[model samples]
Target: MPGALPYWRLSGFYFCYFALLGATAPFLALYFDYLEFSPARIGELIAITMLMRCVAPNVWGWLGDYTGRRLAIVRFGAVCTLISFAGIFISKSYAWLALVMALHAFFWHAVLPQFEVITLAHLREQAAKYSQIRLWGSIGFIVAVVGLGQLFEHLSLAAYPLAIVLIMAAICISSFWVPDAQPRHRPEFAGQGRFIEQLKRPQILGFYLSVSLMQLSNGPYYTFLSVHLEALGYARGAIGGFWALGVLAEIVLFMFMAQLLARFSLRRVLLASFLITAVRWVLLGNLADHVVVLIIAQLMHAATFGSFHAASIHFVQRSFGDRQQGQGQALYAALAGVGGALGALYSGYSWSTLGSSWTFTLASVAVLAGAAVIATCLKEERP
Candidate 1:
């Protein structure tokens, strides 16, 4: 809506940032497996990376909010992430890798929540346009997943760390190009009380609990979906295509999200996403051997991640005051991290013993529980 909006600059940062995710989320576990690490070890390493999100965002968020320097924090975090992640090139030992994951992720996780605050500040009154900017992240993800899949087909999995480092460098560079914007304080929301007090509200607690559960459900998919498909006799390139397909669907969802939100309440959208995600996990668990079933499951990522994420961002923006925006987004990231860590830990331990089918079924159960929370606690509200 604003003529001076730095749309491409904002979108570029998201592109580079999520491009790194595209490489890591689908392939990181496979890289660990290439090192001959056990399933539990791979899970532990991934969990270590995720666990940092629980702390990193909140710390950086506070500093950004207190200092009024959100962009500076984003830039600093990006550089630190790139520097720390380079440690992966030094050692392949489990201890070394775990330390590397934790250090890099601590800084890496710090970037997004603060950047989210920045993005929304830039959008100002045209908040509905948020999805248009965010869709580039999905495109970036698609590019990385498909490109790296083909690259890994020709190159060694050892190339994974290098790919991530280059992408981090891009994220660091992109951060500088986007100018910062401050959230406009709204007097009407001032009476909403302290941030901690708001957090205690049933709806807020329920929303966060549901966020954790949704991510917890995603743990298996992110941690092992590539490995699982590889075991099912699919080629690495095809596996990448499957991941890309899901993001492609996510991109499509983002394109229409402004209109979608206009017609439906956030509660209805979120509840539907949770329910569809439940069925998706079930299909992936039981019938992944069927290409058609696998395709359908992957497509559900539109709901599982795309819609859920867009809705969650809108919710945070609406719920918090100008001063609390960074923290609101930080807490959202932190809770998702908590759920993700639990999911990764449990799925890793269960993957070999309980079998893939059962592991995903467990994921399905977690999502259904999230759905129940949404159905009962979140009220119907237009975004």
Candidate 2:
């Protein structure tokens, strides 16, 4: 594995991948609000995109595994995502937007899961260093959120599609630069059992289920935090600042994640992340007006996303061998899709009716439920 890390190549993919996220995730709701869609309708639109995630990743992941063309899948998905997303420029009607979201998201969501498989395979035995590479994504996210925040502040969100188009183009270009994760001739040496059999283990199922629950808890934060903050009267740049703050915390944690994983048990890391997530949601739900309270809650991103994601990636890497790599990452993405769609769908339906306080309280409850599952079922790895 000497000189192994195609650091910039892999990091560029992550950078552009999350840069697109930075453009869309924190701001899409604002764009919807700009279009005057009701909260429920906004949720529906976001949900359509998320629902695509549940299906597309597994379909593409399976294809990649069967064909051993992980990078090819990434490129095709990227190219088509950009093409499908072009539909956004043609109409703002509910039906039109819904169709565009679904079509583009189908291909967009397909890219990351397979890319994850490529990334880990590239890491070879040095998987612990994943956080370092992944941190570039956080940096890209921070830059996009803050920069785009300022841009949209001065200009209309009408500029958003163009910004995203450019970012998508960068994603397409980055895909061309990376090689296939593993050579077709090299047979997998992951473990003794077939990948499907690994699913029968309680630990494996429990971990996957826990991740979905955690992602479900993130629904409000991802879907409505912008609108919620805006309704509270924060400016767009300030709102972006809050989003950046969380990822900033994430960046710091990612820098040290290798050492943290070395010292802490995965179960311990996950349990702490989940419990703290419960607290963070409660604070965000109740304390948005207070900048200090908001900062504290944002700081929790280290646990909520950084530590939890690192642990989850390692778990999947450990679970699936070389042969099932694509599907393994795909399953993780698919389950997360299930959780995220429900989160966005439910939060959208409830936000105006139930209100932000209650919406996030429900989120808190979901995370605690995940913590309960992990405590009972996550197993220690055998020596």
Candidate 3:
């Protein structure tokens, strides 16, 4: 049965795609710094990517659901992403960089949510295998963060654009390896508006709000922790290792995700993630140069991203059926974009105007609010 699944193909796509994230996420802000951009400007640039996600995924998801050509959409998104990102190498001005970021991200963000529809369609019966395939993404991230960190130490970061381009190429090649999903049609679908109904549920609304805030809270970590640590005098390799440690913990958690899900309620897992995320922001903000504190906070990624994301994925899968899957995932991604874009914008402004300690303390408070919302509003969840 495992052999029958398109395991390697699915895994390879994740590997290549996340490797692209690895190429950019930890280093891009630093690259902005290298170009002498201000904190607010950098945040705006980062926000451009998330801002595109707010629109692109929905447009693509609707196309996939109506046409049943999710893989074709994935391939098209990937190719366009490559074409748009190539502009990065040609431009260095603030306006040029911002334009490219928006263009490529619109296409890049469109791919993953629909691909989620495809992967879940393939794993229709054995969805738990998702963590197994997804772990390779963590592995890819770890490899890129760690290897690129070392490489940048020896060479100027001028090499960064080329690395991203190559990863984009790999993602394009991997797209051809998987087949499209054939969703089982239902007669009740004629009534329409099923997704809108699902969104109206109080608990569902709370879940999306909480998750959006969680990502909003993460804007600093994803967009600025490397720059923050570097400002405090950490070596590039050390910073990369710090990022890798978090994902390594995430990988270990993925390996046992099924067992964790079996024993714990989804609310419990999500609550823990929210609580721990609050703690991580606090530590990162207060003790940047403290290696021991940093390590402890890094370990918390298992809960912040790992457990929280796994639990959210299961919730989405449980909530939406085959016919509605694409839109459902696209909605999930879209909300995250809304939150991330806002977070990045505010965090960027706050980082320069308010200082690191206050900025992250604010992030911690936001996570606390999310936890409280979950505790009170998310009562229906048992899994």
lDDT of each: 0.94, 0.90, 0.89
Candidate 1: stretches off by over 4 Å: none
Q: What is the TM-score of each candidate against the true structure?
A: 0.99, 0.96, 0.96
Per candidate, the number of residue pairs that clash is 0, 0, 0
Best by lDDT: 1
Q: lDDT by residue for model 1 over 1-383, one digit each (tens)?
A: 46699999999999999999999999999999999999999999999988999999999888887898999999999999999999988999999999999999999999999999999999998898899999999999999999999999999997888889889989999999999999989787799887889999999999999999999999999999999999999999999999999999999999999999999999999999999999999999889989999999999999999999999999999889998899999999999999999999999999979989999999999999999999999987754
lDDT by residue (tens digit), candidate 2, 89-125: 9999999999999999999988998898888888887
Which pairs of residues collide in candidate 2?
none
Model 2 alpha-carbon drift over 4 Å, by segment: 183-194
Error of 1 at 317 (Å): 0.5
Give the Cα-based TM-score of candidate 2 against the true structure. Answer: 0.96
lDDT, candidate 3, 1-383, per-residue tens: 47668888899999999888887889999888888899999999999999998899888888887788899999999999999999998889999999999999999998999998888888877877688888999999999999999999998888888888999999999999887776555555546566788789888899899988998898888888999999999999999999999999999999899888888888898999999999999999999789999999999999998999888888887766677788888988988898889889999999989988888998999899999989988874444
- Model 3 / residue 295 / CA error / Å: 0.6
